[model samples]
Target: MVLHVFHGAGYERERVYAARVMFEEFLGLEIALHAGQEAGWRIVRGEEEDGKELRLADVLFRTPQGEWLTEKAMPSRPVPRWHTGGHPVKAPLVAPDVPVLYGEEVPNGGYLAVWDGGLQIGADLLGGAFWMLTRYEEIVRKERDVRGRYPAFASLAVQEHFYERPVVNEYLEILWWALRALWPDLERKKRRFTPRLSHDVDWPLMGAGRPFFQTVKRAAGDALRRRSAQAAVRRLGGWWRAAAHGDYDGDPYNTFDHLMEWSEQQGLRSAFYLIADHSGAGEVDGDYSLEEPWVRRLMRRIKERGHEIGLHPSYETYRDPRRLRREFDRLRLVCAEEGIEQERWGGRQHFLRWEAPGTWQAWEEAGLDYDSTLSFAERPGFRCGVCYEYPVFNLLTGEELKLRERPLIVMEQTVLHRQYLGLDPWEAWVLIDRLRTRCRLFDGEFSMLWHNSQLVDQGETDLYRRLVETM
Candidate 1:
């Protein structure tokens, strides 16, 4: 079935393309866009006509003097502070006739107006989805944290207190209901939702690449920080065991074997993003070389065990195509030398440093199949306003990139690190469960990033084990 959309003449090409993606690719609809007026279902930028016309348009679209409806138009509306299943939402639709997923009370004139014959939503869902899917706020909001990363607080979702909610999915649901009401034969693609577990091996080994003095210094620092001589002694003993006996089972950061065993027992597969290049000073890349014998052996073992050995592009290559190509090429060469043949490869950016179309362009040029780096460093939630994996689009050029973005829902550091939420293991598990439920509700993939180094800690490791078992 073809759903014709009649849009205003002044609409931007990028916005139109984004709407097409949301409707066609995401919402599973065949859409045909028309410049002016059309016959069937219509979407206009003005007041609705008094007739049996099935139309959907936001009141902001009727702006007498603006290029298009934007966040500026939202201020005039009664911004209601609302929550849906513990996820914050703003400007909720509250028309008594319109069925809302979650809200407080039905307002006199809700954002969405439903009737027996037609429906009219007072908000531009297409534009809103475009703004979020393209990361428009990141480009417009010129605020960055110490690491030159966009802080979650600086995001429109956070400012509007909806950071934890997947508003795009909510909008899609609204659209789905409206369309189904208008056309009962509408069909949608369905898939089983599951967690896509991944690990970023930022520090593969704590003592393998460090100097002897540095190892001792680390032990001393641990002793002082933890206020326990026993912890220091254990650290030194683990180093000695790894160095002399080639045993790393006791090493705090050496949890590869444990992870493999746990995954096997739980009947789940995971991807390990191995660092391909070393970083310069003031970077967060791994210290050990990818060519190290132990590293190569681990890669081979991971491949043999049916787990993926993906590349973890260094911090410096986040935006540099040349650097990213060099790193990816080196990783491919190493994998080839190890006799590992991967049909397609995927990975995430080190430190999660990404810069819009440039980063997507670099990944496309480098020929990476997919990337899972679109999550907040300071908070664990839906970063792209959705929970599903979708192909990325270059917001500037209005071209779809070859790379698929597996939206990351949670990262271990974002939840437990002192610099982030600093939640205890139980609290973190609760938050993870909540996010996972949202993914399940939408039949979306729940992508998670758990660093291999974090597994060395007993509490963190136990939490991961429990999560896998429950899943």
Candidate 2:
């Protein structure tokens, strides 16, 4: 099978080259070149056309008798071996310098190992010569040092890619090539990847029917209706409390009774995040020391109603590591008094204020199981730059921490935020639908955030609940 590398949208060519180098080193092998191009190889046609376009990588040899040939192509293959041997790869090792601009953190240095803005070179074209050489050296060392056991595979088990929007096609081709070289049998047997639809909603009935004319007609009607209602609401004001929860306001959703009732109806164990002293003035303190009886009653009722309680780790705590520890300490004590033995497993930073590496360190130190504050409210996409929850290395200590980050892909304010795409609830929902299309690209979890206060009945919050109900 021919290998192909497809980069994601808008990936820079230089970055692609760098990624190729890393991959080649991880896998110990020489990529056969297309005869004509001479610059890099690409597998175009069949074996006869090999070396012509530098099309495909030479991963294995197969004889006419259907027996697999060794890399050395001996009459009889030697017994299969593990890794060809090598030393453990250290962090911050940069590939040979090219003209490309690197991100602030060196490879494996910064909080994020992969940023989406990197470039991509065709897998067979630019090739991965440098990386292959490094791996070979490492392999030879392993063979010399270890008395027994070679690496089962020549390269790293996992591969990572970071690219922009436009070059995803090229990225895919490169992935196909890499997979072929690393796992020939697995690659040949597996089917190509396809995006899947995740969220469920009524579309055709909600005026999303066919034809350009129909969409335009419905959009115009919606615009007019919205404008008339906005004008009437401007003339007569209602409760403006909901709008105040923007940035400074904390724990503004006082609808504990309503939430408890709704959660019971749905049989969902919902978690309510409470900010400690940072909560707005006049709000009751629910910490361990001054456990107000009413607040305890609310927590008890919530438990009885089959919901969960969590802390909305305040924004200030993210920078001050101590704050995070203390806040979690207080939360645990409160939960203890309530006799809830199950340790809390959820966290979302207040205001989404976070530094990736620091936030992770804080979470690890606090013994938190998951952090759900990775996404930004201004952008409705992968905030940690990765779509899945995988154990990440600590940027400061280079330790592989065990905490998981559940990326929040969508948030209410993210849609209405004026800085980026200023989409109303309806507009935001449309964007969310587009994100849903991307979710099918991988099996990663799709996380969404909506504050309880944002759903309150107010002119500004007119369409928030409707959008949520649609979800």
Candidate 3:
């Protein structure tokens, strides 16, 4: 059968996706057309082969406006008697749990098939406006401080970091138009949404247009408050504790059901980090108390769905090593009763705010197996100066901390915030491209943190889908 491989102009530039050349070479297919060629697709090879071999065609190109340009003539190739799905392919789709069976020898185990597992993409804007507002205040304070050192420093910093910079503003406009053009079907008809404009967007604010941000902010804040209140009610020795521990059973967030589908789709197994005392005093704005029953049920559901549960240390938990241990102990009991492993290992500090050396000491004392919270507080670049996971050592003591640091590369809030490296879609794309290049070279995982709520399909979030697709 004819195997067609369309090499679009832009797609050819992506090194990750450029393996089409090798694929074409192995298939012995001749390109009948080059879609993005200046003079349209000109057949470089014809029926020159003495025998009938499969021919491939480049059938697509990019127009000036970034739309795909396609050609009309189609090519056909002889189907091999042994070929299936247009080619003689091997194991096109494998079952999720297909294990290799060894003949005889010691008892057989499943066959080992390996693929690049380090590559990943995600975003997080959890705590939404709460986190952004704090960041905004911090930025203003920094701007003030810098002005004392140098008069022009404030403007320089603003131009470089703030999302309201001229470059970001121009890019955002283009990105907005582009997303609207691409996904008109997903557009909301109600103009009542104020756009989260660049100037009005604080790190705590949601997106690009103020009007739209207000709408989402109200809805999101209300939901957050409700979730917070419900959590508080549960923590008051209420039925939530019983329900979560399976004394009374029901799933909150339907986490098990949804995660099952999602994990299956991505061929991934997740490790969830649950906050032990989200509402406790000194938990750093941890005023929202979720029911113990809800939290327990969620943990059970996560385990049932084949995911691991870890601890998301409250703000003060890191401040006191003993308190951190106590928190983990309490968490372990929940896991133990559920017939799951009770060890509290992984951690992601709340707010990605931590004194590096001090926090490393706390993690070592608490014995976390891995931590995924290392990233720049003011930008979305590599904080540890590396793209790969490595041991995090205490800066003061110069001793290796007893944990692995999986540096977070991207978070949704960082890009959308008015402070920090507030990037629009185009700038975000440039960042992604650079990160992707590094990942390709080092074969490193682009571990990202995207909050579930930030996946909303409008306003300043235009780059999200593109980010995912590019990766």
TM-scores for all candidates: the values are 0.86, 0.48, 0.45
Error of 3 at 402 (Å): 2.7
Off by over 4 Å in 2: 1-252, 256-269, 279-290, 417-421, 458-471
User: lDDT per residue, candidate 3, 242-267, as tens digits?
Assistant: 33453322212222343334544555
Question: Tens digits of per-residue lDDT for model 2 on 1-471?
Answer: 433332322213332333343233222233432223222223332344332221222111112223222223221122111110122212111111111111122233321122232222222222222222112222232332121222212212111111111112222333444434434452222222221111111010111112334434444554575444432332122212223322212222344555445444544345666554343222122222226554566667666766666667654676667888888878778877887555545667776666536677788888887777755444566434334444544533535566766666676666765655577666776777666445444433556665654443363355643433333
Error of 1 at 368 (Å): 1.5
For all candidates, what are the clash counts? 0, 52, 30
User: In model 1, which regions exceed 4 Å deviation?
Assistant: 37-54, 58-108, 208-210, 225-231
Best by lDDT: 1
lDDT of each: 0.73, 0.41, 0.39
Q: Which candidate tops TM-score? A: 1
TM-score order, best first, reads 1, 2, 3
> How far out, in Å, is residue 125 in model 1?
1.4
Clashing pairs in 1: none
**Superior by lDDT: candidate 1 or candidate 3:** 1
